[model samples]
Target: MDRLILADTERREIKALLNVSMDIDLNETKDFELSVHRSAWDDTYQYGGYIFKPGTEIGGRIGRLNTDTALETVKVCGLTWRGMLNRKVIEPPAGQDYRRISGELHEVMKELIEPEFEGLFLVSEADTGVTVKNHKFERYTDLLSGIIKMLKSVKYKLRITYQEESQRAGYVLVEAVPIIDYSSQIELSSDSGLDFQLNDIRNGYNHMIVAGKGELAERNVFHLYAWPDGSIRKTPYYTGIDERVYVYENTSTETEEVEEKAREEFAELMNRQEFTMNTSDLQMEVGIGDILGGRDYLTGVYMAKPVENIIYTTDAYGTMNVEYQLEGED
Candidate 1:
C-alpha cells in the first residue's frame, strides 16, 4: 500500500496529517479519499498547509487526482488518477476541417497524445507498427473512436501505475498488433482460478464468405488443429450448433491470406469465446488488459483477459471486492 502523500499544484510540500485510502481498479473508474480532521484552526498543532477543497487537485509522489474533491463525513471523496480518458472533441482549422488522413498508430499517438499525458507508454513495435485505412476523422468524434474505427484487428488500453520512486503515477497506452498473440505478455493465474463459463462456442461454419465491393475471391474455410500436444484434433463444427456461413464486410479481398486472416480473427472474436469468472480474489496489480490463463476440471485450459470490472470497497482502505469479466477473445 502506498503511503497517502499529497502535494501542492507546484509539485512541492506533502500534506500534514490524515488517514487515507485508495483503489486502482482495472477497466473501470474508481475514487480514493483523504481523511482530514479539522477543528477551528488549532494553533496548538501545526496545520494549514494543503487545503482540501473543490478542485484542490493534489497528487505528486503519492498519486494524481481523477476528479475534483467532494466533502463527506470528515473525508474528501476525491477521485484518484487512474488514467481517466474522457471524450475529447477536437475541431480542425477551417478548410482542413475534415480530410481523409492515413497514418500508423504511433504517428497518431505521438501527435494527439504524448503532449498532455507525460507518463504515456506504448507497444509501438507491435505488428510492424500498425497501419490504418484512409478515413476521415470527423471533427466531433472522440480520439479513441476515430483510431479504432480506422484500424482493424487491434485493441488499445490505458494503464496507470503508482508503484515506483520516479513512477509515482505512470499512464501507458498499450496496443496489440494486427495478427498478434498476447499469450506471452499476459496469462491467467492458475492458482487464482475459480468458477467460470464459456459461451458462443462450437458454431458451425463450412465456409466463410468475406465480401466487399469489387472482389472475386472472398471465401475462406476453417482449419482444424491437430498436434501431439493434445489439442482439438478435429473440425470444431457441428450441424446442430446453428451458426454457419459467416459474411464479413469491409475486409473483402481476392487474396487468400487477407481473407483468411480477417475471417479467422473475426470468427474467434464473434464466436467460440467469452469467459466470465466469479472470484473473491483479484491481485492489486492485475490490470485491465493483463491476460490470465485458467483451467477448470470440466472445461480444460483457457486464456482470458478482463474487459469490465465492477468493484465495491467496504472500509476507506483495503482490497476491494471486484467482479470482472475475463473474456477469452481479445
Candidate 2:
C-alpha cells in the first residue's frame, strides 16, 4: 500500500506514508514543500514504517505501491525537511563568503539557483541579450530561502516547473507570461456544476501602471480585448474605472520589458470574477494554467484561466477543485 514515501535517498525508500498532502501554485515555489502526516502507530514494530531521524539525506515518493514509480528527488537538509512546517534555523555566516555572477538568462539562473537545485535545467523564454547584474546574497539568511526571496525582490516574471531530472537536468522555466493553453473549452451550469459564484466583479480593471525607481520610473498600459463573437457584453462592467499599480524594486528590468509586463498585469486582471467547477468534468486532466469558458445562469457567458487547481485523493479515488480567474483577452 506504500502510496507515499519519504526516502533517505532517491533510490532507496525510507518512510512509507500514512497520509500526505501537497499544494502546487503557478506563482509559488516550484520545489514544493509537502505536508505529510505519519500515523503514530506506523513506527511500532508491529506496524512497520521506518523512522525518519533528523539530518538524514531525504527524498520522497508518492504513487500507487508497486505500480507507479517514484518522483525525481532534490537534495534537502533532513532536519529542515522534518514535520508539518519545515522551518530552518536562522544563523549568521561564519566567514565572509562571497558568491557573484552576471550573464545571459540561463547563466544567471545557473549561478543563482542551480547550485541549490543541483543538476537542474532552466529554460528562459526572454532574449538572453538582456543582462543581469551581479548580486551577492546577504549573510545569515538560509541559502534557499534567501535566493527565493531575492527572486521576488528582484522582480522577475518567473514560475517554476517541477519535472523529474532526465539526462543531467531538472526543470526550472521562465516565461514572458503565465501559460494558458487550453486544449479545449469546457462549460458548466447551475445544475451541471460543482460550485459557482461571482466574486468582486467590481474589482475588475482595464488598466495597469507599473512604476520603479531610477531611470525607468513608470510605465502604464491598458487592457482591451476583442469582444467574443456573437456576444452581447461589449465591455467589462466594473463598479468604477478600476486600475492598479505594480512596482518592482532593486531590479534591472529594461524599459521595454517593464512595459510588456505591465500589459500582462492588465490581462490577468480580467480574472476578477471567480469560478469554481468540478474537475471530474475534465476527467481530472485539467490543471493550472488552463483556460476554462462557460456561462452562468446569473452572470452569463465568460472565459477564465485557472490560477489555483487543487486535487484531493485517498487510496481509491480522487477529486479536484479548480478556482479560476477571468482571462484577459487582446
Candidate 3:
C-alpha cells in the first residue's frame, strides 16, 4: 500500500496514517477519511494539517476530526486542494474596479492566481490550447470553482501537481490540460470479464428556451435546438420526435451572449451515454477527465465517455480498490 503521511502546515513530516480512503471527483473537491485508535490521537493531528500520499501527487488538508469514545477510534476527515484553494474567493485586486480579467487560460492563471498563492503554489507553463475572452469573475466566487467552470467551458480540466520531497515540497503546481482521450487506446469489454452499468439518455431534452435580462416585453429570449447532425439551430428542427424543452435563464443582456449561453445550455442537455464501473480487480489505467471506451456485446452497446469521478480506497492490508463514474457523450 502507498504510504499516507500526515504533515504539518509547513509540510514537515509528522507520521504515517492507517486505513485512509479518498473519494475524488472532477466536478467537486476531493474528500478523505482516516481512522486511528483513540490512543493515537494527539495535538499534532489537528485540523488544517496536510495529508500526503507519497509517490503520487495526492494531497489533502485536514478539515475535521471526530472521536468515538465507545469505539475508541478517532476519525479524521480531510479536503483536497490544501483546504483553502477550494474555499478562498477570488477577490478583486486592490485599486481594480472588478475581478474581470480575460485572456488565454495560462495568462489568466499567471495574472490572477500566481500572486495569490505566491511561493506556496506555482502555475505551470503548459498551454491547454484554450483561450477565454472577456471572462468575468464574480464576487465571492471560489478560486478553484471558477477555474474549473472556465476549463469545462473550453473542454479542458485543471491538473494540480503536488510536490512531496523537493525544494518545492508541500507546494502544488497548477496547469490546464486537455482531457486525456483513451478511446482509441483502451477499451473495456465483456470479453474481458469486466462488469459495468450503461446509461443512455434516450428521452432527454432536445430544445431550449433561454430568457435573458429584461422584463416582459423588453426581455431578450433565444431558442436553440440540438440537431441530429450535432449542430445547434435557432429555427425549428428535429420534428416527428417528441420535443423536450429546457428553459434556461441568464443574467446577460447582450444578444450574442445570451444566444451563446443558450446554445451551451442546450448542448449540455443533449442525449449522452453514461457508464459506471468498479475497476478494483481490473486496475484500469484511467483517471478523472479521461475518456474511456466500453463495449457490452450482449446489448451491442458501445460508448466512449469521460470519467467524471473516482472512488479509491486502501484497506489495512494494503489492498487498493477503485471505481469510476463516466459521463459525457463526446
Encode model 2's per-residue lDDT on 170-248: one tens digit a residue: 2334332333445244465556544544443534343333453354325333233322231213244332334333332
* CA shift of 100, model 2, Å: 19
For model 2, the local distance difference test gives 0.37
User: Model 1, 1-330: lDDT tens per residue?
Assistant: 223444443323344434443333332344444443343122222222122211211221223223223543244443333323333443455787563555676666455544544443333434446555565665556554454444433554433333223535322334433422344554444455555555535443443444544536533433443222323323444344453555555444434345434555454634345666654565543444445445554556464544444344334443335555554423
Q: Candidate 2: how many backbone clashes? A: 2
lDDT of 2 at 293: 50
lDDT of 3 by residue, 152-267 (tens): 77777777766666553566677788878887877888666777778767676878888888889898877788777667877767666578888889875355457755776776
Please give the ranking of all candidate structures by lDDT, highest first, separated by commas.
3, 1, 2
Off by over 4 Å in 3: 18-29, 91-107, 125-141, 152-155, 166-169, 212-215, 240-265, 328-330
Ranking by TM-score: 3, 1, 2
Model 3: how far residue 217 lies from native, Å: 3.6
Count the clashes in each prediction. 5, 2, 0
Off by over 4 Å in 1: 16-18, 23-27, 30-72, 78-84, 90-107, 114-139, 144-156, 161-193, 200-272, 279-285, 301-303, 307-330
- Cand. 1 Cα-lDDT: 0.42
Q: Which residue pairs in candidate 3 have backbone atoms (N, alpha carbon, C) closer than 3 angstroms, thus clashing?
A: none
TM-score, each model? 0.48, 0.40, 0.80
**Against the correct fold, how does model 2 do in TM-score?**
0.40
